[model samples]
Target chain A: MISYLLRRGSRVVRIILFISFCNAVLAEVEIYGEASYENRYFVEEGLFGQDKSHSSFTLSPEFYFESEDQKTSFTFKPKIRRDSVDNERNLFDIQDFSLVKVQDSYETRIGIRRDFWGVTETVHRVDIINQTDQVESFDGEDKLGQPMINLSLEREWGTLDLYVLIGFRERTFAGEKGRLRLPFPIDRNSAQYESSAENLRTDFAIRWSQYYQDLELALSHFSGTSREPEFKAALKNNTNLIIPYYEVIDQTGLEVLYIVGGLAFKLEAISRSGQGDRFSAATAGFEYTQVGILSSSLDLGWLFEFNHDDRYKDSPIALGARLTFNDLYDSQILSGVIRNEETGETNVFVEASRRVRNCCRLSFESVYFNEGTNSNSVQKTFEYLKQDDFARFEFIYYLGN
Target chain B: MRKLFKHFLFVSLFIFLNFTNADDFDRGLEIALATDKNFSGFGDSQTNLKMLLKNRKGFVTERKMKMKLLEVPNDGDKSLIVFDSPRDVRGVAVLSYAHKVGSDEQWLYLPALKRVKRVASKNRTGPFLGSEFSLEDLSFQEIEKYTYKYLRDEDLEGKGCYVIKRIPLDPYSGYTKQIVWIDKTDSVILQIHHYDRKSFHLKTQIFKGYKKYLNKFWRPNEIHMINHQTNKTTTLFFEEMTFNTGLSEKDFTQNSLKRSK
Candidate 1:
């Protein structure tokens, strides 16, 4: 790992030198980032041997440089985290390190970066480029930087993006001491891969997106190692441990969004092969907002989504609401509930945040899970997390720009 | 002969009143068109903005952002605003495509999530960055968005001004009408009195320290907005305003929003 970091360090040095050379010709550089502290408290004891609480601190710094002509730019962002209880929760990753050149109709970017795709608020079935940084957040909103060469073209029809992804990063998992974990820990070091090239495999993706009137649509296809992994049981240290098995797969995705007045309709669907059998999944939802509700400055938004996965027999529906207080502090709250129709399992989540003074923000989040009353029903891996209900608070302070 | 003379007087008086009203309407629209035309050839502009939001208790909060605008020939202008401070919102950007009629199009880019979300434009009455200025107040102004009537002539800050009353065309607009003061010499806006839906005096905006750019375009260095009802005020200061930086449509796309700093 040290050798690998050294190799990456050398490349960063070269990029800085190039930027310094352009500095003489009017290139500008900006430095900014954030430091955050988090405290988590669990309402229930873990099913396994785990701590009832955890504390973590994170630092993420960003450096950006742009040319005077606005045609060339470079960005570097590195993040580090230290956890008090769970060692596996500790993280060190470069979130973004990329250089881009923009032309009249085309743009090219190279190096590591993060990319997101999808419109629905509940599930992002079409966002397949970056691997999930699960240790950072189980909600799957956080992602590790993907190293790639991206080419984007702007045409009359739409915007076309092509990506050539190099190498693969394994998904992080919780340790035995982690609260939000399966019955057994995942032995990441012994992970299995279907591809002979293993983590060295290269991936390719293409997407074409466009906005027509009030409708926005995108079609994408990906051929690479699947970011989602299947699990197998293996014996480790006199105990059975879960071993993740990566698979090579091809995926085709579709995204649609239609906006009318204060309402938006969204749909994201995907079909994938090489994971057991060819299957499809979809999430369709709508968000309706009422601005200045009740003659007040607060805006209220309602969201509803239905999720279906072919591999899983159970279907789930999600309902959510977002409230924005257009006050001086920019306070907002989002709460949601997802329930399975067949098993009656439910998950509830809430997040509220507001800006503190000038450079700081404070947020509170809580998540709860309830299992079906039927004990004879099929036990899913997520059943282990039923007792992991927790609430967390985070305070973030941003650095100067 | 007396009855016939009285009927003739009535007919002449009606015609004269109709003609004067038509003239007033035409004159108000002509002035609005002239002001829009005067600023048409700027092509593009870029500026840094700093806002000081002061509450009724004299407490203050500051916000900083950068603005870029590209002129569209027949349609409304396109603009991009990127926040720089209140450091928590740094790198957040909003891209907008203003239209002459109907609702405008807006998209918000969240830097941390790398997500570009389409925003509903109907919420134009919401405060911008928690400041006294609403989203509509900062949006591009199009002559078609309002109906105008010539109120009178007035003197503002020692400058000859044309006072006009204009009502918003959007049903969701928070204001019922606005009284505007435009400089007669340069067609620059000097001040405005905004009235709420109840026709109550709501706010007053004063533009100060105007500077001419490219020997043609008039730009304001500072804009002071005072909320009469809430006793809150927001002052916007513009720095290093530049024009004709050669920005094209490509610079305002969703792809560019993610790249903005």
Candidate 2:
């Protein structure tokens, strides 16, 4: 696969050279690049003791070259990072590299990637995974090595759009003994499973989006299976619990005289099914924006969710609220019953951010999670505040024109 | 010999009248400014004005406005006007002065959204209502905005006029330069050549259908600007203009911006 990709890349380069030669008589080629750095700190109190801190500094650089005619363009980006914890020392790593091409209004990209998904915005990092555990779920540092290929195409028609993506990966997983045991019951030792071998996998996804004035609707589907033994084992064990799901998100909003806005409606359903069992969830919510009496913009929203499982004959309901001030401060509260067994859970979180300048910001966040039992309950809380709070700062500077 | 002397006298009288009229070109501009300056002279006077604004696409729109002049000056020399029409923008007002450096403010009340926004100290060369009429074009021509050089006597639209070229003094002005044709009869501006910042001829504004506002002041009821490059046009019609109704500076304050109507 590596050789094939290199051959293709060389062919593309040759084509670009030919095109440049042909256009060299009339126009000049332009190359541009930009670089930025970000420092993030996370503090938490729970699980593995009272105080745990993770700090990472990241550098992202991108380059692009275009023909004078501008009909064709190419872009490349490489991300690198350095991380430190407590005062114990530090480590460096390379993340991934991406390449993109554009022709007219159509664009094509292939590379190891990270993307945000879902109406509620979930993070999904493809291919590269050095750090096993992180909230954003991707390696914090650049590895310079281990990159995957990702391809995507998108087209628009009037107010409607269609997008498709495909990804290829070759990865290795640790053996099943010790810390690598399967999380659930599965045929981990089967001949079909190779826990510590090189593997290949493919993922396919499609999305359709349509808009009418202020109303928008989106429907997307992703279905792919990986061949890695660990993944296969995990899938087999959770087959009953893992369902192939589809989601429909619809949003209708209004901007009253370009101010004092409000949006009403529901996220009808997200349903999944596997074998003979079916699982589904639905939510409805309303949001409003108003000038608070204190001369600040305030957003208030409420949501309710209902979930059902045919195999377990379980049904659950959840309620949530979100309040935001000046779009910079936000607080959320959610409580729900997990199953017909009446397993209850509640979560609350608040975050605030202040812009130091065009390129810098200061932020603070805290979260609390509680699990309720028939007779007793357990609770965990996490909070993170910038230490220098007053002195800690980030700066983003641009180079070139 | 006596017949020859009589003929020469008649020809010389004709020449003297023509030269005097030529000299009165600036006087006409002065009269036009003075007519708009006197507030009490115009009492309940109504007139219809037509405006045409053009872009690259040629004639884009035409507006017909009815204007009512209320009061002139204390001695009844100048006037104030109010505009009414184009349902979306009915209660808009403008106060103008013939003098330079004096505050000439405009207030607009949008009834649909129930808010009044005051236009304050804007660049004179900026477009009015997204049209080619710069704020400078609407306001009375001030000497400070431009340095005028009298060119020569010429004929435009069948009227004898003094052609003068003016270079704008404002460094940030949208127009690099301008040329105006002032009628020798009443100081009426008949045509103007507007140049872009790059010193390129961008547009031309023409004035016509002159009417005497108070017998001494001739105001053009129709004006048209043709964008040479874009071939588009925009027209503003002053439906109703009332000169003076005891409008005070207090009415132009920020507190009144949200409640003008």
Candidate 3:
């Protein structure tokens, strides 16, 4: 199965390279990327008999080409990760392969691409264009490339972006041997879809964004197969496995950011239909920064956010701080805590990183989950992670220019 | 009768001193306006820059970037800086819209996340790219951002210059005042001595290798800044500075920041 996936991945790369080769005759090409080694140590062993520690290596390289006039450009990026313990944790992806053409007042991009939306730091409720690469990180900040044809129009009123998405990418999950896996293994091949076309369903999205003096706002709507899935327990090979069901969804999202002085107020709200009910969710917050704090070249930023979901009984509040040492090494640290309102469960995470020499970087991250006394649904969903606290260290060596 | 005579004498002296100060202020403003006008009407410019940052211990690191600037008719210039080196920050760009009267606007583009984030421009005192130059030091010096006073006339590097002291009007400025030397020949700034907020001599920036472009614009090919307090230095070397690049407003917009290579 892995070999088949690798073969399919290579085919996509070949097609991209052939098209780029034809364009390279008259274009200037630039190549750059990084190779990183990461190690993760779990404070406690997994309840499913996982290893105490795991290591991995990742490589992601990018090639870019631009015409002499700068009116046309192309980018191709592919990433691969190899895990030391779990096969399911391994990954291979074509993150970006897009060709862009610019005109007087408009631009168009075609092929697989990754686009980001929303502005909040904690949770991104409106950034739903791409599926999450769960095995890479649980924060959902990592995304899989989506095949799309995007058109962007610039007008006096605002900017409008229209997207015609071609296919769907299901979220990757941890296997049984993975540290963050659920109690039962997930059957990767047993995914069911509400749409008859399944992974081939065509999706559509549009976004309009504008900035006025001190405020920036965006409104976006997407109608397609949902990036999120519901799990159903099924008996396969005399063992119970969780099967994923992808449902059709229509979602509308709004993002607003108001900046005044050193404080930034942000909001990301979304209304979605077709899962179990039409539900509304919002994450509202503010980030206040004290630059050059305490007569030193250090900036301390305070983040406060309130997250609400109509489908869940919990309204979690997160508090975080980001410290940037405006030093020679460009050191930074971010730490946050989220407390569940109904269950009293807490989640704490910290990330610190600094540049090493000129070509390398070192980073450390740790995540801890404190259990709640109540047996609420939100707590139950995260109960498995209570003992899966882990600390991770990464060393990245950049290459090329 | 004697006390009244003394009060009148003091009042007259105060009026005379005020009159002399007003003349100095007008002359300072006139010189600043002349310098601003001398560099005007270059429509746009594109330049490549290499920055060498040295620590107190003499360890040097290099950073490469490209700059595009659009001269606004009456307000502050719009500029975009794209980093090309220090591999981790490659493709990261900063877009700035500086105004004459109020605070400047800035945005940062992070290529890793494809995020164009609005940055608080009030942090102008912070170092840029770990270099000796602060964000404020890099921006175009709008005439309205400071109030000036004529200090003296002196010769710098064998060229006659007008020495002036300018106090920053921004409440959050890192420097209390700056002493600037503008060459009399072309009105180009030759050097500046920056004073910290505590009234201590902090840094000195020297502009060298002046070359005339289009016979009207004088640009310095090299800028060297030294921090007196930290004993650190940063030198900027410019290359291929072409003016009138035909860059429009569309090129400096937020969307363009994402596409900036």
What would the per-residue lDDT of candidate 2 be over residues A312-377, giving only the tens digit for each residue?
333444444444442211222222222223444444444444433222334444444344344433
True contacts reproduced, candidate 2: 0.00
TM-score of each: 0.92, 0.38, 0.94
Tens-digit lDDT track for model 3 on A1-401?
Answer: 35543654575466447545744673456877777878899998898879888877777778788888778889988888878778887888989999999889998999999999998888888998898888887577888899999999888899999999999998899888898888899877789999999999999999999987778999999999999898999998899999999999999999999888778899999999999989999999999888778877788989999999998888989999999998878899999999986877889999999999778899999999987687655545467887899999999988663
State how far residue A276 of model 2 sits from its true place (Å).
9.1
Against the reference, the lDDT scores of all candidates come to 0.88, 0.40, 0.88
Better of 1 and 2 by TM-score: 1
Q: Which ten residues in a row have the lowest lDDT in candidate 2 chain B?
A: B252-261
Model 1: residues >4 Å from true position, as ranges? Answer: A1-28, A372-381, B1-20
Better of 2 and 3 by lDDT: 3
- List iRMS (one decimal) for every candidate: 1.2, 19.3, 1.2
Off by over 4 Å in 2: A1-46, A49-51, A64-71, A86-106, A113-117, A121-134, A137-199, A226-261, A266-278, A281-284, A291-342, A372-401, B1-261
Candidate 1 lDDT by residue in tens digits, B1-62: 99999999999999998888877777788778778865698999999999999999999999
lDDT of 3 at B216: 88
DockQ of each: 0.67, 0.02, 0.68
